[model samples]
Target chain A: MAGIQKNISPTHIDILKEVGNIGAGNAATALAQLINKKITMRVPEVNIMSFDEIIDVVGGPENMVAGIYLRFMGGIDGNILFIIPYRNTLNLLDIIFGEKKRDLFCEFDPIERSALAEIGNILAGSYLSAISSLTKMLLKPSVPALAIDMAGAILSVPLTYYGHVGDTALLIDTVFEEGENLIKGHFFLIPDVDGYDNLFLALGGV
Target chain B: MDVVKVGMADLKIVKNPQIITTLGLGSCVGVVLYDPEKKLAGLAHIMLPDSNNSKDNTNKAKFADTAIPYMIDLMLKKGAKKERLISKIAGGAQMFDFKGKSDIMKIGVRNIKAVKENLHKFNINIVAEDVGGNYGRTIEFNTNTGKLTIRSLGKGTKEI
Candidate 1:
């Protein structure tokens, strides 16, 4: 497990701080379309630490969540992590799209999937494009997977995120307001070496 | 071709141009079933893996175990054949940082499991599935062609 290095890796942290600042800014741009309103995203709180540290602060196991994980390849290759609590997702959507007569997450409706996907898509694209400008690689993004809940499930594998600073997980706090709803969306940057390396392979650069 | 929205735990059936849809999936599961011959497709979004654990029907769509059975029964009542029917599913993303410590909200994994169980109970197989990840998936089903398209953020649209 790589711990945070203050002396030897200040440069790495600096680069990531810039990365996150831009990523959050871009995410706000994407949200503007769906909600039809301007989004305000604050500068993300960043840290560099091991996986165990993540489990400590990220609520608890039973927390229902929504997330988008994308593998950036070549020009800008890494993990782009984004998440929000389930209840907040609906509340945020309701705010952006106006009051829904039905539950924002009415299970049988797939329309919300598109709405959420659009949000994730634009954020990832914006983040990658920013990174690509720096890395000079054509950043390609993968699909967004939104997990509805985690009741009655088993831990089968270790998951890594690449949405952080200086080899550490990057954490962000996003604020969304459309109408009467003000919702917060949290973003994480986990370092997924496997996914990153996969991108290298995809472009025949691996 | 009327539009019917299915609630979390509930089921809806329609004939001739009926559009049934759902909103955000996050880690929840979307189960879409359609019979080409009958031109009937029913979509259910279930939260948890099983309803046996929940005594309340309110969260029916939140759990796969309960929602799968509930959806299948609804289809049966609408005169869809068990063997003639096939299913398509999407949405299951790991949304939070667990640091691999606990599988608490592996809801995506459990949702898939419950869909499998309930489908098995009725002898129906999932023809296709788009699942797992840090990304959210959106699915659209056209009963006319019985085609389901899954759109993942940044991943583009894929027909399963």
Candidate 2:
């Protein structure tokens, strides 16, 4: 397998950033509608980095987090991850269920877990749909999987998929915020090594 | 004592009075080989089961098959005796539950199996193991004491 790192150029990065922007914009709008709160998203940052660096970007190896993972296929195959810190997860749960019953370290009930998964499903669907419409590529996302654990552990699952081909991953990252209540979350779009060519090609990159 | 951090798909060797660590191992396995008599240890955070599966095998520490033999050679060069080497392993967790039977979902199990097979190839005894759960782990291997400290969120900390 050829390394994606050798072929990535500044133009490729710009295209990915644009993808993140459109995708995250749609996701933010979907989230706002879900919670009925005004959500703002930062301009997405596209980075090609090692697996360790990607973990650090989310927080750290041991940092407690709630992660939603999904795999997308069709014109392009890749993984999309949504990460929120523990406190932010609590705040999000509070808003979604309209209650503050769960503590910081408490286990989530079956309904709470399903709620989290549905949120992931919506966010991933919106994000991928935006990209699909923009590039005219058919993209289908798998059923969302939710895991509340260490950032390193959760990210390692996706990193292993990329590990077979290369050490570095191209990450399109976007952060979402909901004002002073501090409902911040990070969204990462990681396309596989072989998928890069198809992605850049679909975007009309030479 | 200094703590040497091993990044993902990386490996490190430390002598007495030092600690070697790898963080947040989800479906990845952290393999620790220690020579208690020599007070030396090596830690490798391996991401995949085999190097032959990938065309890019340049990163030896990234796969279980390549990494174990590489660490063994390094430890031997540093005066660690092969006969005294024992293994302590942790990590290799599912992390998330996926309903489908995709190969990716079984990576943790595959990683653990590959690790055990590699260690066995080197004739190293696996003395202790805490693996195959749906949680992430941060592992620190202390060379001086030949102990592996595994810490997981909400799972409590334990040493073996």
Candidate 3:
């Protein structure tokens, strides 16, 4: 395994944080609109972490989460994941389906699953468009794939891609909130290995 | 009993009453090797199927091809007999799927195949496995009983 390069400059982290800020801001807004509630977010966190450390950010590998995955289709290639805790998933479903009716115990119905996927699509679309405008690059997002599983298992997909190069992942984490509840959703932007170079080059890096 | 944690692209060995574990295994596969007589076990969280494609293959525990041998060598050093070794594996999950995705999206399948092939090369018998699904899993190996317990989100837990 290649040692994780601790070479990401502070400037690069700042730029990535800015990118995350704009993208997640748009996503939070779209979510807020869908639920007809006020949404707030913490300042986006941009950092490079090993796969293990990344798992810790979401409450460890065994913790259950609902993850939304989208592959980037143009100019840049990578995976974008929006993760929400199982409890938060239920909360979002409740808001979308308007209940007391949706049971958290049972499996999500097909309609509920579709609703979740649509929500993921909307958020990813908005986020990508914001970054597209910022970098003057056309970014297309694939239809979202939703997985409800242990955080480690859900993360294995992208980690394997990065494993061919290095074991570290440069990620942008944006935390979302709804009123006092702290909805506990995060958007993780993981650019592919080569996609990092492309991202920096497009962002005025030498 | 002490518990040793094996992170992604990592491996560990433990003895009787102790446990070795790896968490959040989506496309990654976890291979556990146990020697019943010695009461010793080794676990690896293999990230990719092959190390030849990697620029640096120094981390022997990161790929199925390399990790199996590395693990066996460690087990031997810990008094585990190669002849008595048996394996149990878990956690090669697809996680998500979409139409028109490239073959690389099937990394979980590739990883499982690679692990099995490598174990075969080492002549280790695979006694049990819980793999190949669209969900993630966390696995633990109990060195005492050689039980591999698999845990998944909302799917409950099972032991093999």
Candidate 4:
């Protein structure tokens, strides 16, 4: 195992970025298939960042967002978060369930919330599977949990794990776009400290 | 009129009329210390309870065990008397729920306890706090009046 006390090396970062690119690319394709639309995604932004800096990555800590949270239960431990702007969430829900009797944009009923979770599950699962194939590591994802709240609050939940180890966290950030920018969203993969060595070694990057 | 922003695992000290703020404190504790006579205040948005086991020691302000003492020392250096200091805190919320409780899920409670323990170590009295729920909070502290205001989505603003 690599030294946990040491900062990430340049080579480690490069390898992780490549992994992110492959994973996010697969996830984006999966999303396009689910919605039956041409979805585009930007290159993944992979870096080791502080908790504070991450708040700014997805707009800001106070920005209201809809997040789908899932835990990686096997192989490597980590958290996968799918964050979409509240407005984008409404738009996506419209596509999933179509226009209906929903009167509010901020609040989501149970069914709408479930739809969002399902979408998140599909996308995150796709990303994980791609990474698993590349690394030859067995990976399993837990059920998804949804939250519609300030980005800070939602992010902090998973961040607690990293906080105990160090102030810096490795974030693989990817942006997804659908239908000429009708929908925009972010995906974050935050692996635990130990998981980093396990993953990199499994991928033969170490 | 200057509002200094404190980031997670960060701390800041200010005097008179200056406000210090931290946002998006879900399951994290925001500790605000104020000296009424000097009108000096310090805010520490600490992310975790202890740094005793962490291999990385670069960020002292990121943990409750280290941040409190660091902020107090800075405040005293800025001419604020420790004997006159009082504390007001906010933002220790359990953002999600699970059927079987895990230690990670109880981070908010652990953070609150850690903050209080550190305060007690310095003999600082905690005057007010708004904590322990399933929500996120943004907090601001006024050095002039020593007021801490808390804000959250859906819930209205609250003052501690």
Candidate 5:
């Protein structure tokens, strides 16, 4: 936490904010195509947070959730998390994929796996694109890892919430709209302060 | 003919004139009990490995741990002989990457284990099975023929 406050945060957060907005749109489009329906997706509200503050803000222990986890590595390294409720996953899927007939012995198998992958690809791709277009910073992404679990189990890694110099945590809140379902996910950017310092120190005569 | 559909944490038993099926089983396990002699077949679309985790302790057909025993008992009560019972199992997928490390979170693997253990406890042998991996499976059982088919989009259909 101390290392985070030692570094400046403004410039980094401004860039992520713009990228997350575009990412939401891309995710919406992918889901639309996957389900073969015309879906309207709304841009999400973006926020930034360190590891600790996020666990507290994303609702308490009572919440049961299922979501997609995608990690960004290469030029930029961070994780993307989605929190979808069980009832909502069905409602949203029903609109996009249509309802499963009770008498039909609904075969919803193959599609579920692909649906998760497609969302990850689109949202993560759009994010990298947005960051490059806005800040001219080149980024690379990896294949996403999707799973369903409690909010606490998903954010397994330890995060430094409060920085040494700054007491506040940065958070980004965003929403995605499609059919009647509204999907929300949080984007957190953690600068390995030492990594950034190494970049600049190596470049400059320090 | 009626097609009986089972939902999450639900179970149904039907014979003759009806066929039973369940879809999109990720970590969930689907257990089928058939009595060829009596022409009675019961299928359980179970969510977890064991019903012990559920709040309802009395209902044995709810979890992977209890559903098999429960189905066999129901069949026995309906004039189905104990020696005539046969078992089949499917579903339990790895869904996510675990950094190539072993973890207890793999529901697909755990489901398979629970079903195998419980079946042994009840002395029911699995006649067929399709389980373990990252892919989701849809299982269909034809009561008329006592045959079950497992389907995955990425892979061709196979009878297990």
Candidate 6:
């Protein structure tokens, strides 16, 4: 574990960033098609940080968000989390259902929750497929699970999985934007510790 | 009056007039050991059930098995008697309703169980607890009153 951390060169970060670029690019395309709107993405940021810092990246522990989680197994092992702020979730629902009900504290009905889950499924599928094709690794994503709650709580689930091996986690993060609506969402790709070695090796790393 | 924030996989001990807090506990458990008479409290935001599960266990506060004992030792050094300490725990919620049969999905339950077992091993009685749900919780422990205040989104705030 120490060896992997010590050996993460700048080139490795760049590789991970490029991986994020491809995966999120494909995901952005799917999201754009689903909402029938133009979408833009920021350059992916690859960070190695502690569990607490990771929570702050998603808007602190108390920030309310609609989080979609999935675990991938097979060629690589890791978790993918797609998080949209609570307000953005309502905005997304408005766009998908073609309605203007923008209640701040409105409850998400069963259908609305399912719709969000399906969106997560499609986006994550595209994202995983992009990575799989890039590395020629067979990555199978589990069913998407949705949780609408505090960012800290939702993020803890994934961090705990990584915490077994190390105190810090390396993540590739991407942000998506919608032009007029200003709706935004974040994607966090966290590969397990062993998966990193395989990923780096598959990308021709020593 | 000052709130000392405890980060994830971290621990802190405070004396009177100070409140200790940990935010966004999902599957993680926030264990608070308080000595009301001494007016001292220690809080640990434990992430995993056991330190032995990991190859690297340098961070003692990251696991229930290691964190509880470590905090107890620190409290004892600061004049908190083991007999006077009472436990109040929060967080350890299955934040998502995952349908898959993955072991990680049951992590919240496992964490809660492990925390209980560790506390039992220390012969500390848990006075109050607000745990086990599909929600995230942020908790604050008051050293002066030995009150654990738990806050959750849409679930309101309550003291356990």
Cα lDDT for residue B71, candidate 3:
93
**Model 3 accuracy (lDDT, Cα):** 0.86
In candidate 3, position A68 carries an lDDT of 89
Docking class of 6: high
Task: Give candidate 4 misplaced runs (Cα > 4 Å).
Answer: A1-11, A100-105
Off by over 4 Å in 2: none
Model 4's CAPRI class is medium
Q: Tens-digit lDDT track for model 3 on A63-115?
A: 88888888886778888899999888888887877665544435788898889
**For model 6, how does the per-residue alpha-carbon lDDT over B77-140 read when each residue is reduced to its tens digit?**
9999999999999988998888888888989999999999999999999999999999999999
lDDT of 1 by residue, B93-125 (tens): 665434333343465676677677778787777
Segments in model 5 whose C-alpha atoms lie over 4 Å from true places: A1-67, A70-144, A147-206, B51-59, B100-104
The superposed Cα distance between candidate 1 and the true structure at residue A146, in angstroms, equals 2.3
Query: Which lDDT tens digits does candidate 1 get at residues A28-118?
Result: 6766665666666666555644332443334433344565555555543456656666677777667756667664345624777667766
TM-score of chain A of 5: 0.65
lDDT of 1 at A83: 63
Q: Residue B25 CA error for candidate 2 (Å)?
A: 0.9
CA lDDT of A141 in candidate 2?
91
- Screening candidate 4 with a backbone cut-off below 3 angstroms (N, C-alpha, C), the clashing residue pairs are none
- Residues B26-66, model 4: lDDT tens digits: 98999999999999999998888888866665678878899
**Residue B51 of candidate 4: its Cα lDDT?**
84
Residue B147 error for model 2, in Å? 1.4
- Best DockQ among the predictions, by candidate number: 6
Better of 2 and 5 by DockQ: 2
Q: Answer with 3 or 4, whichever has the higher TM-score.
A: 3
- Local lDDT at B113 for model 6: 99
Error of 4 at B13 (Å): 0.4
**Residue A62, candidate 5: how far off, in angstroms?**
29
**Interface RMSD over true interface Cα atoms for each candidate:** 15.3, 1.4, 1.8, 2.8, 14.5, 1.2
Residue-wise C-alpha lDDT for candidate 5, range A1-206, written one tens digit per residue = 34344544555444445555565555556556765656564444434443324545555222334556654544444445565654555555666576654322233465865675566667667655664454445656556666554343344321211221232334444555455444434433333334334323322313
